[model samples]
Target chain A: MTTAEVSAPTTEKPKRDKPMGTETRVAWTFIAPGAALLLLFIVAPFVLAIWFSLTNQRLISPLPTRFVGFENYLGELADPLFWKSLWNNFRFAAFVVPAQTAFALLLAVFVNQRIAGRVIFRTIYFTPITVVMAAAATIWVLLFNVNGLVNGFFELITFGNFAPDWLNDPTWAMWAIIVVSIWQGVGFQMVILLAALQDVPGELYEAASIDGAGAWKQFTNITVPGIRNALIFVFTVTTILAMRLFDQPTLMPRSPGGPLDSTRTTMVHMVDLGFGRQAIGRGSAIAVIFFVIVLILTLIQRRFLKEESAQ
Target chain B: MTADSDVRVSAKKSVGANPLWRWVLYSVMIVLAAFFLFPLVYMVASSLIPDDQVLAKSQSFEAFVPTPFVGLENFSDAIERANLPRVFANSVIISGLIVSLGLVVNSLFGYALARLRFPGRKLLVGVVVALIIIPFEALAVPLLFMGAQVGWLDTYQIQILPFIASPLFIFLFYTFFLSIPRSLEEAAMIDGASPVEIFTRVVAPLAKPAYATVAILGFLFSWGQFLWPSIVTRGVDVRPLPVGIGVFATTPPVSWGDIMAYTVLMTLPLLVIFLIFQRQFVQGVASSGVKG
Candidate 1:
């Protein structure tokens, strides 16, 4: 065909492409209910929260509610427990996020193999994903209790030489939270990574093996890069979740903070401040700050991920 | 030739194929599996043991083994003392309403964003998508303030209404619906069906996977939730299972076995439902790439 004939087919098709002919009236009607809910629940609460964070509001006190102009924010910064929980929150996230990511990635690699009982193993590992945080928290509390199965196993392995109070001891309480979190959380990321792994071509591995790359080398080079999007997604999510870590720590502590505030997390501190003391202003301030952290962390992760993909 | 190849396949499948490596992988998985199960298995085994036995074994890994003696005292006490039945029913009702209503509302919104052209459609989609990352804790205080002002507190509507149209669920449905061909909706339009009719009869039915995903994820989320219910509701009238379990921690005469028993009772229903529809759950969560 002539060049004009070939170009004509592509050029003319754009004009004939059907218009997206949806009616706006019907569309508005369809979105109305959900839009209303989002407005009332998500948006309204978010706006109100920022407003409340500036006030001296109490849940049921006779004190008149009035704006305090970031006093809650300043007050929280000075409060030792607030700062302690902030560090504790960061410490918890730092410990759990990388551990869970590495653990899940390793698991995804193993189960991604054409191994025996993969189905059974996947199911077994994923049981915790279905568990309520409250339920998982209860079980872990028992296991971490002095002389419970957790310590018993430690002692058994050490020939009766070691056992620590996993829950009550400040030194071990944070680690207990970390370990159970890894247990409860790994299955989720593993499942995501496993799906990501399936998208990697078998031929890539074959080519690497033929080129004399060892399993670890092939994994680092091929598998990791292939699932880069998923890795970022999982890591970012795990971090955000770790920041808000509650339920597990909440159940472990006799008080809001695990003995001496060891296992206290940011959101848990916010909850204690907000509901326990009915200090709505400070609690709202804490939440708003944490929300900013989550927002920034998520955006940075997305940017980093985009750069990786762009590379 | 077929029989010979089948024999080779069986050999490859067996632990004998690569005996050493196979053994290592198997042992690793088994060990890992046992580690994963340790908390839950311990819970069940500990719950079966008498409170005294559980306490006695609390310091040992031997605590994992159900005692030489066992009884249902924990289960009975949990049922009686904690008012387990009431909370369980309350949780079921709340989860049920949220899941069922949630599917309809979210799917409708998702459908609009996916298939329709409207004024501010892009803006609305942006709003929903943006709200997805704002954790409920961030919203709780103000939501409480809002709920109390509207007299929604101490009621099921307070919990149900706020969550019924989850931004994430809408996004999930939107993703699923976006992949659906416009031709299908067009065909229904040509048949003179109204938009809602086209949605309900044509669009919704074809989106079975989306529905299943939304249902399972919604159920798990609504059930697993502690923060919101803990914030909104008080007294036994509207308390969910998790909150029910939590309140006992502060109350006097706390019994560990009873707590474990309640945990088991609270957890078993969800586990069973999840297992029954696990494929849908996994597939739903897989594409969403985030746990509810």
Candidate 2:
């Protein structure tokens, strides 16, 4: 039997009844602008990028470019800088993915309780999501300065002189960027998790309480299990964001990576190679590699989330 | 009977007694909330002070000082230095155009995916989802070349056109359309309504909330767009506020005070939008299963 025979008629329809005459033409007319824009901007650019990746084309040189086949890819594959930046991006993802998930989940549970001034707290927590990237980075640059607010606060608390310039020092630059990312990101994930928490049934919590479970036990066994779907969602999204880390380090007047190229993320490297240096072929190769990596990770995450939801 | 009553009374008493752990939990939550809010508060407070006293180390309570205040001096300076009035106008026009155009395209595509049976529907949806993961930087170089070739460079078409059919918005609207009851549209069809009529009269009215959700998200993304406009525009004439502020912030004299003021200026419109639509943004965020 064909697949169509087994499906309901509603699901098995294969054609649209063309609303005849001028209306049908008009409908297409309405869609023409969008269709044209998508073709010109999205589809055309994607195809062009693929073609450019296979040729040695520089943005500055207007001469006819020669097709190099896979040479660009080969060059990127052998470059040590590519490997180092790729490794750094993965490391950043590893730290951010787990830490952000745990922090967002914990904060969601804390705020889930029916406490006084709940709305106010929610607003306060989610305010950072609205902040522009430039502004946020500026504030962070000041705070992470040796004599700025964060270090000054640390000294006050410890009663010892301990101040390291966060964006300047190689040892701390990546971590510093990661910290800013988390501060910017935590609120968004928190809101998502909180929504998930609200959606979970309250009877399960009441039953756990009646069974003489402590707060910690209830949270670990009941709350965690209940919001597993949300936890997976947060992990996948944050992984994507962390892999695309660019603006903070890019805005710094120092090296794109800052302090011995410690903060050079893969995306930043690709941008510099393509736009700044005008090596389109090499940059396209990097983008393709980066795209492949993200694809594999997203597939893995989707599979994990699917399996968890199946339970 | 007396023994049963006493047992019930004891049960009620135990239920009424709040746990000590809950108190500590509330206190911890409050502290966490305060900690997260501190930076935003500090940013706003610092922007209110005169440029002379901004980083002075003399006044210990400088950020919190309400007296001897300079009102909107930083705002005026930031506006003057950054040419923010022009940037704000540009941002508003770009965001408005994108959102308006995006709504039309997404609605049509969403309806096609949801109700109309067409060839390659599943394939199209899959492509949209896959497009979500392709980072914007991947296409930046070719997109720039395309813009140059088409004479769209430094134009509104460059800023607004590419963003019109966001995969995220298409996915969002598609899901929303699927959830609407088919019977309503079916009835409309039976009553001699065309697909367009049914959509405009029935589905569109019912889908207001979803449209609002997409509109806000689209507007916010366009407003905060820096990387694309930064490369494409190349000057202050067509730059959005985020990139405009970014360029101005990097310019000489390095006034943290003016930067803060400009930051506040850029942030104020968004804050106002959020305040006015607080419930919608919150509800929209909750209903949409995706994170920013």
Q: Against the true structure, whose TM-score is highest?
A: 1
**Residue B197, candidate 2: how far off, in angstroms?**
1.9
Per-residue lDDT of model 1, residues B54-169, tens digit only: 76777656767777545787899889877888899899999999999999889999998887764456666667778888988898877777777778888988978888989999
lDDT of 1 at B128: 77
Tens-digit lDDT track for model 2 on A171-259? 88777777777777787788889888776665565666689986678678977887777787788878877877788777652667667
- In order, the TM-score of chain B in each prediction is 0.88, 0.87
Flag regions of model 2 displaced more than 4 Å: A1-35, A253-255, B1-19, B58-61, B66-68, B249-253, B290-292
Q: Which lDDT tens digits does candidate 2 get at residues B162-187?
A: 88987777778888899989999989
Global Cα lDDT for candidate 1: 0.81
- What DockQ would candidate 1 receive versus the native complex? 0.45
lDDT per residue (tens digit) for residues A104-184 in model 1 = 998886776667678788888888988888888888877777757677778778987778877778988899888878887
Q: Which candidate wins on lDDT? A: 1
